[model samples]
Target: MPLLRSRLLPQLQALLDLLLPPACPLCGANLPQGPDQPPLCPACLAGIRPLESPCCPRCALPYPAEEGTDHLCEPCLRRPPPFAWVAALGLYMGTLQSAVQRLKFSGAIGLDRPLASLLADRFTDQVREFEPDLLLPVPLHRDRLRRRSYNQSLLIARVLGRRWGVPVACRSLVRTRDTPPQQALKADIRQRNLQGAFRLLGPLAGERVILVDDVMTTGATARECSRVLLTGGASAVAVTVLARTPRP
Candidate 1:
């Protein structure tokens, strides 16, 4: 029966594909069965540069190893951001940039699972180490959530929580003030823009929490969340994100 089921599986998938063809949510390419269902093609996937070692422990910037020195990157060293620690899956350039763009702007919401799964798979151990009492995603203003109908950060937090055995509190944090987008501002301006933006919704006493976000560019948003969480009586605040844009 097992062998019969295995043999019929491909045939069933073939019928399904023929009936309703699948396409890459990013590029709209026809998605075949087997390994092809993972969304991004090999060429596109290969362009994603994962953040390997020799990175800033605080900001997660991929840095070159120097002689007998393990220190911060320029952006981290010159003016450190507030988070206690950070871990990222990859660089926010090339294919990763486009993938996030498609997911966030183009409304290709189907890609969230694969992307979040990839992030969870890579950071499962680290997520455990972060020892988050509860997973909290950066909250979107009601207006933005109404327009997008989804928050990719929460999607990622849910996926990571399931994989890492950490419970998620979806409404743990609230965005009290609706701020403009962070992508258009300089680091200093970004910091000011995000200040007093995040606040705790319910009781958060002595909990070790980690803030989950889709991207950490200037680290301002995460820092603001961390500050809010700490002020709310969280013992420690760490950040886990999908990408970190290195200084150009």
Candidate 2:
């Protein structure tokens, strides 16, 4: 029966594909027919610009030139965030931004697979180096979670954990309060809004955790989450996000 099921599943998937057809989530172009190719077309996939060298070693913000010096961003140099470092897949722009929006706002949960696969491939080296003991998705407030019916971060984190053989602690950290959207607020205001918003549910003493989120704008949300985790006795926290909005 197990062998029969394995043989039938592909035939079923092929039938579904032929019936519904798959289009690129970014551009609505017809995707190539195959199990090996990502849901995105070749052009859309090519447009994803991975963050490269000469970036802030702490924040992963791209620098303009290779000055031969690894310098921290002004914010990092001054106040310093709670997280030890950040690993972002790319800048929040182009097809990447579009894909994120669709998955986040439009209820396109199916996009999770491709996006997560992209992230895993892009940040495999950095994530391996960090060697976090656990993966935690930045939680959504109860109200927001009910309204959205899902946490996109958790979905992405599940994929990463499955692929990397890391255990994901989905409920270890949670949002204690619902705040207004951060995109509309200034950096200082964003920080203020996120204050006391997150809480750690279990002890993380001396454990390294990786926080997953869909996007990092001012880094305020990640900062607040990291603070709570550290206060709960986590030795260190690193952030992993799909994209980073360039500093204004």
The lDDT, on a scale of 0 to 1, for candidate 1 is: 0.81
TM for candidate 2 is 0.88
Best by TM-score: 2
C-alpha positional error of residue 125 in candidate 1 after TM-score superposition, expressed in Å: 1.4
After superposition, which runs of candidate 1 have C-alpha atoms over 4 Å from their true positions?
1-23, 28-39, 64-70, 74-82
Candidate 2 local lDDT, 2-64, one digit each (tens) = 999999999999998899888887678888888686757899888877777777888877777
The sequence of per-residue lDDT tens digits that candidate 1 reaches over residues 1-248 is: 99999999989988888888876556667665675366565666677898877677888866655333346877767877666788787889998888888878888778777677778877777767767798899999998999899998888888888878889888989898889999877767998898788878776789998888988887888878888888888888889887888765
lDDT of 1 at 181: 93
Q: For each candidate, what is the lDDT?
A: 0.81, 0.88
Per-model TM against the reference: 0.83, 0.88
